[model samples]
Target: MDPAVARNLKRRVAAALHRQISDEQRATATDPDQAGLRQRGRALIEEEVARWSEDYSLAHGVPPTREQDRALAEAVYDLLFRAGRLQPYLDDPEVENIVANGCDDVWISRADEPLRRVPPIAESDDELVELLQDLARRHGGGERLLSTAHPTLALRLEGGMRLQALMAVTPRPYVAIRRHRVASATLGDMVRLGAVDATLAAFLAACIRARKNVMVTGTQGVGKTSLLRALAAEIPPHERIGTLETEYELWLHELGRLHQVVPMEAREGNGERGPDGRAAGEISIGDLIPHALRMTLNRIIVGEVRSSEVVPMLRVMTNGEGGSMCTLHARTPHMIVDRIAELCLEYGPRMTDALAYRLTANALDFVVHLTMVDETGVGGRRHRFVSHVLEVAGLGEGGRPAMNEVFAPRDGEPRGVPRTPPSCLDDLRRAGFDPRLLDSPHGSWSAPLQLQVDGRGPGRRPDPHANGREGGAR
Candidate 1:
């Protein structure tokens, strides 16, 4: 089908369906449920498409084919209730990220593949902006605005994807969509994916069972969020848990194993300012943490600690139940402490460097750092694995936190190996961890990770035995 014709038909059918739904709601005096609404929408789409086919046949003496009609109706439905052209990409299990710089410039990053350009999502720049506006209005509960006055948009999509868009301040509207590939993963699942070995997986599960405060640190595009989700899966199902985030990402509430989950997302405010000189209705993650504490949660899991939220998050780890967890952005395990201190000094005006270090050392029990090896430029697949697990002991020299290297990459290997026993090994043992696993310096990996770097040149074929697991979650 021609792109132009498809776009026109989709727009027409979507508009008609919207009007029909509105009329039905007014007549019934009650809105339908989501399943009922979709059923009605699809029925309306079929009727409209049949009518259009009849009219076209009368005008041109040839009706559209059945396949074309079916395709057209599905497209129209997507435009009305889904992500339009982007819905198919989102539905693809292998697609990891989507980037759109304009209507015609789009890029897709998939598992084990180099970045590739894709077809346009919209017919024009204005249409792309309109599409984003429609998405914001539909998914953001009518509270998000995307116009010249408020040109930035951030929200979670239907299946836990995080989307960020920019307009009016850049050359063109830009969008980045990141998918949570392993939203429901557990430690056993992580082991199957080669993200962690069996021994490490058992250790991590024990850490959660022992009620330790853990912080996952990694750079962007690594698997910090996924690891956090897997760690959360170790918590007892009967325990009540609260999750706070700037946007909904971890999605711990969706896991069936967790019985009691309180999920909270921070809200952006209207453009107007209040008497306090802040956005009128803005709600920060920091604001939600204290409120979560008052809810009698057994544990609090923060999505990410990037700003002043670190202040409250550390406090939660200290004052709340001991199993509190969160993620942070850091290049290496050694940099985790410095990163937390920097965020505290920058976002918390009253916080000094010494105070930040003290709080972090006192509140955090362990730091799990993930590493990504992107060899796509050299004809190799991207590999992500846990490379380091640092145990925060206490305040050391120069008022910095002392750390014990529980697990570390050894001899240029990208995967972590057990190095030192944690100071609280007794607690882990009580939680069912085997101390003998730490006796093996190589951990539990069955084989070394095969890579393209063993004397292989750029564009050389990857070894067949190389690990081909899919990349990690957002």
Candidate 2:
């Protein structure tokens, strides 16, 4: 027998025995050798019984008893399936992200906090690819593995989960699975987790409701899109929301319209790229801008602005609705402004950096940023919304939006610059925003953000899904 398998059995039996027998009582038992033998033997018996149940189910059509069913599940789990290389952590809900540095090690994040190694999920490059494909197929409908010919692929899973895989021409193949689950959420959840205060969260909710063109920026695995969606979830029921992305993401209230538009980048050899000479006959996000307008959307939400789509997105949001939200990739808040400005110039090369900044500054009303601690950081760090809310006060002379260090929850309390003039707030006021909302605490403010709040879906509402609400997310 493989030593690993035998040792795993020993460890599992010992653990089960410990749970079944009290330490003090076990110490008092006579014939210690026989007692120890019996404990492990009984554990093995139970373990085998569970394993047999699973095997029986696989062989026959019958379901096992609830006890037998659970044991069978554990036995199957202990069988060392291909996904097992990562071990117990893979099954742990607290872990939010898993990263493969190479073949021998895997890392994960807990509670917007730190990355810690549990175990590797594969033995070699090939095994890792297999697990990657399996995960992709499970989360996404399916996936394609490629070499230099295909290069890279990114798709949003069926539930708006994001997955990206890249194949190399030189180095080894690399795969990353970014989990979208957040352990702590809700206004109260945020306050308890030290992410944002009720006040700041309420302010953010207000920002979303008013239809501010907001962008969330964060490093990889920092929960940028999650924060954006948390805010977007507040969009009133009456609005028609059309979301464009490479995957299906950006959910809204059940009563509102949710249209998922997947924009696939044209590939080479497939002869997809056109005159642009980039994105392989690319249907640039610029290509998708006109499509959103065609939808007559009340608001547009882009997953993340990683490319020149930044320019077209800005143009669309500025021209379309006064209230929209998007996410951007950046290490910091200021970097987000610069990235957006740089991307805009891709579409309008004649536009100066100053003009680009002004466009982003004016086009965006606020900023929210998240950061995940590097694994090397002391005491192992985690990802958190470090810069929760930033008020974009237009472009400074240097072509960066003057970031107003507004009230961010410090130790769950509002910190940073105090209230500034309400140019953005004034727009909401003009739109008939509730006047009494500003004075409420973080969790209680219920101001509505919509050009006009709708309490129903788009003519045809899908029936409420069973087991629909996961955690607290609606």
For residues 256-302, what per-residue lDDT tens digits would candidate 2 score against the true structure?
43333323332223434447554443444456767777876788777
> Could you give candidate 1's per-residue lDDT for residues 286-385 as a string of tens digits?
8898899889899999988878789888988888769999999999887888899988886656899999999999999999999998888878788899
Give residue 411's error in model 1 in angstroms: 1.9
Clash totals in order: 0, 17
Per-prediction RMSD in angstroms?
4.2, 17.0
Instruction: Supply the TM-score for candidate 2.
Output: 0.64
Candidate 2, lDDT over the whole model: 0.56
- Predictions in order: lDDT: 0.86, 0.56
> Candidate 1 at residue 440, lDDT?
80
For candidate 1, give the lDDT: 0.86
